[model samples]
Target: MKTANNRLDIAIKKLYTAFHDDCLHPECCKQCAVGNILDHSDAWKHFSDDHGSTKLNYIGHVNETFGKRFNGYTPSELLLIEVTFLKACGYQLPLHFKNNKPENPTNKDNLFKGLQAVIELLCELDKSPNVMDYTKLFDNLRISKKSLVLK
Candidate 1:
């Protein structure tokens, strides 16, 4: 079975490959001349000591003390958020099916449509407190939430 990092690498590679018209590139590389994936999330900023001044020291300070916004989402959770955002925006995620071939290759029109839908959905959710609670990464996306989801 593929590990989480492997799955993430695959997804990122596809995103990088497709946009650069490297459909037949056959592999992903750091010097792809288009895009590269890296960890830059709140969870990473709040946890890793490598971030130096930016690190929130979330474990020793935030969650261990007041349980502030530093919830320290796992790598898998981050991957889920990334993949979901891409899908919600109509990007074709490079997921392999057990039987049937995957459908819905992303195109410019579909991407625009998906983005429009996402914006409308967020706007609608903005008026409703209950709906926004399920989404934890909204702050990262610069979305404003008036209150926490109590459920």
Candidate 2:
């Protein structure tokens, strides 16, 4: 059995990948497998703002100044890449909203609750090393000088 914290942590981990994975590697790099893995180069060409900053983008930039990486990849292709990468990294993504009912019939309260829980958990994780792969992730993606506010 899992506690609220455990459940929330698990949910946040998935949300972390959902929100990031794309921006960590921009499309400006060399194209091919490496390029594709880094960022969907095609997506950036089609989506980046006037300046290189990836703000006004989609597919969940969250904290990363990012937009969606279109890169001429079909939705299915993107899905395959993300899924494969996650699997290779030993992550199994969340199911797309399984059979859970909301206490209120029409308000979408349950879904919103889950989203809120996930966002809160992710925010906590951004600061604390509470996530599962914190060491590996922090090492690979160096923290920015301004971003790390050590107490």
- Scored by lDDT, model 2 comes in at 0.34
Write model 1 residue lDDT over 14-59, tens digit each, in one string: 4434445533111122211111223222333334342112233545
Q: Candidates' lDDT values, in order?
A: 0.34, 0.34
Per-model TM-score, in order, reads 0.25, 0.21
TM-score of 1: 0.25
lDDT of 1: 0.34
Could you tell me the lDDT of residue 108 within candidate 1?
47
Inter-residue clash pairs, candidate 2 = 42-71, 43-70, 43-71, 57-67, 58-68
Which residue pairs collide in model 1, if any? none
